[model samples]
Target: MRRRFCRPPRLDLPSLFPEGSGEALPAVHKVASLGTPRRVLALLFPRLPVERLRHPGPLAIWAAQGSRRIVLSLSPEAEAAGLEPGQALADAQAILPDIILVPEDPAADVALLDRLALWALRFTPLVGVVGANGLLLDITGVEHLFGGEAALREAVLDRLARMGLSAVAAVAGHAGTALALVRTGWNGLVPTGEEEAAVAPLPLAALNLEPTLMGVLHGLGLRDIGSVAAQPRPGLVRRFGPALARALDEALGRAARPITPIRPPPDMAAAHDFADPVVTREGIEAALDALLVDLCRALREAGRGARRMLLRAHRVDGDVQEIAIGTGLASRDPKHITRLFHEKLERLEPDCGFERIVLEAPRTDPLTGVQEGLGTTGRTERREELAQLLDRLAQRVPVWRLAPRASHWPERAMARVSAFGTVEVPDGWAPRPRPVRLLRRPPILQVMAQVPDGPPFRLRLGRIWHRVLRAEEAERIEPEWWRDTPDRLPRDYYQVELDSGARLWVCRAGPMGPDARWVLHGHLP
Candidate 1:
């Protein structure tokens, strides 16, 4: 039996930052001096779902879990009325019967989180999402842009407050230490090399341990981070395994974990903040030109060219419109890149005018200076011009090139691939001549032939009968054994010339018998 499979759907998360120091890491280091201690910020939204609704009265969000409904989040008023998350809904209502209840929307909450992460780009480009309702940012050398570390923390909280969100932010030398401090309602900066002292007094829950492991720790009377750290490493590992010790080490900055940002930082970037919001296309075009000049100059200085460029327009109403373009070849020409983005400028909607515009190239390749022939247009100049033309046409339509694939099956010998990507052809492999055009789906044909595997003498197409004048020797093609099934069979192909001098490509599927099938596979020119 032949088995069929369906292809999986693709995940669309272009904003997801790649793990480790992709191409963006080197640029981040260039902004600050080397050997600088990492400064991380953990921003938490305790009542994210409730705050999203903006309900002034007491409210609680609940969801169905198993056979009963439980509270998931609570507003400040609801919290003051003796309600809490994970509490039974029935019990919560029994305490405050007038409290408003709304169903939980995890998807909406997540979407809002992603939008907030995008908004955070104004503060620093390195923004990462922490679990469900929190964010992590790396502000190692970016604090000076907003005065200092303390001012930056306040600025983040103050801006989120203006947007009607309840945010608690904490900064520390390590990511884990910052997150632990934020959960405890501590909103201050922990100096470098003091992560151990900062997280020592926090509760065991701050470590975010598994419930089972937490239970064992509580049973053993280890209830605080300080107590857990006081124990010897080997003894703790023997009793509670390595996870306990590892978590402690991470919290104390003895170990480190890199933050996976919501968007990959760019290789080179430039931004312009408008004193007054600009609403006209002319203003936007002028700003974009200035930005391109700065970005291209940076690229030239680095001896590199951008392959992918992204433009972000931050509107006054907090919405961001992004336009992206890719080139078939690396380029740093401001005029050329501007032309590519010209067609896409209308896609941005200036709801209340754009407050800031940023341009960055996330993907780049090393490109040395190219010298063209002295007087006339040279091959090198023509090649670069061709790539630019292809890039423009591709913006409006799909463009690709066909490459040869390594397969014996006629239908699987060719593939569509990227125009700029490298193509590999198998070595020392040659195929027999085929038709100029192969049918996408071969149709069955009625034929009359000699007995015991002889070539067909005549074949019928619709109501016309064509007598075969000559038949070439059969070329047998076997199915690829790895993909073979019980129903598949070998094929014998022949190029037969008819009386009218028309050559047809036909194939016989299966062995010689009354059940044998004949298919007109292609038309020969």
Candidate 2:
């Protein structure tokens, strides 16, 4: 009779191999042909250094154990200088001559892991985070869905490799056993009834015990799991503490260990992997349309709307093209997003064909209220018509040309104006009695005749003669004395109407000081 085996609810072993084959398997052979089958994910944070935390800015840093380079998230200058995660400050300086160091952003890493978890859910839901940089997935029952266990493993490895990820994997009866096997360079499946024996030769460090406990184990000459298991349970518990004893028991299958699987979010992201690369605007648009439609359906069914959408186009040459667009309002309208993308598509040049398109909306807001009578000749229609006109004008003229003037200083107000989109003017801003156009720098002038503290008699501005008709003497203003400025000039300003009916705003520089001069500062439109 064949040996009876019990399978738990979450455990499925038939998916791994064919059933009922009564063949004796080798207990512990380091098979050379298959090589080391440790499944490991090396999260290489390319930027981080000890010195970077001093000044806070856009960049972040992180340090990893056993890593030579300091990981930094700075620009090319920082990376080229040899900064990476976990590099010593002095060592980093020697390695990278002039790179700046920054503190690591744990928040960003957590967010990245969240995204990775979402992506990994497509393969298996039994994913768990291993430290800050690695993830563990229990591909038991799910492996068969991809084919046999070997084929599924190969597929996973191949997919990750194609996505430019360096990962290693191992399959075993338990997670701890699998982790130990993978870390110790044992990548294949450990035979039945041999989980304990398989992990026995590995180091105590593989059990993920605390460093203090590991040091104690080392001092006690308990270097490997086999040595630790040889000790009496009560003595082990009393000497090394309960944690180490528990870890040992769990490794030996004397205690049960359970793993909590990572769950995917309610909303789903849809993507497509192309058999061949597509390198045209039309191709990108087509791919985007398909992804948008699928994602929209998912959002609709979930009663959600996306406020921000991110499109990632994977190129054939391994570069990821990311395009992010934020809507003015929360919208579940697929056509609106598609149209916006269509408008953006004209500006993009796909040098090489894309292999995949990933549409992700990690941020979503509830649909507020339905917009009724959208196509009618009301406020919405007027706004749309105005928008179309603005777009046409933007195409002909620069966007900045249509922007409004921004200023707080009444005298120097309206000096520079940007395009409409670039400037965000606040609502309910009442215009002051200031000139519509103000000069950036007031021009110095020579006065023919003038009263000491009154409006000018006759002003000669750049060889042009102007007669003052009605003079309006505005208040005299002084510069902020505390602020050091060698070029700061005291001024007596006058808003005068010219004899020709034009208005000119002028100022007399150095009103009470030496080297005083008259200047035509600005004009009132």
Best by TM-score: 1
Candidate 2 lDDT by residue in tens digits, 1-525: 111111112222111111122343221111112232222121222221222233433333534545444443454445455455345655666766555555466776666665555455444434667665556665554443355556666665666566545456666656666666665555565654677888889998678888887887798788999988888878878876788877776666566455544532223355555666777777777788777776776566557687667666656544556666655345566677776566656655467776666666756767534444454657856654554454445444554342334333354333344332345555654465555666777787665445457676666666787777778765576765565386786667778887778787777766633466766667887
lDDT of 2 at 235: 89
Q: For candidate 1, which ten residues in a row score worst on lDDT?
A: 1-10
- Show model 2 residue runs off by greater than 4 Å: 1-153, 160-166, 170-183, 186-268, 297-305, 332-335, 346-352, 371-377, 383-408, 411-430, 436-453, 456-471, 475-523
What's the CA error at residue 132 for candidate 1, in Å?
1.3
Highest lDDT among the candidates is held by which one?
A: 1
Q: Over the stretch 1-525, how does candidate 1's per-residue lDDT look in tens digits?
A: 011111111111112111111122222223454566788889999889999999899999999999999999999999999898999999999999999999999999999999999988766677889889989988776675566788888877877887788888989888889988877777899989889988998999888889998898899898999999999989999988898888898888988756887876777677766767889899889988887877787777778899999888888777788999999899998888999999899998887898778787888899886532344357877888888999999999999987787778888877889887888887755756889679988888899987777789999876788999999878888898887786689999988998888899999998878899999999787
lDDT score, candidate 2, position 50: 22
Task: Tell me the deviation in Å of residue 158 in model 1.
Answer: 2.0
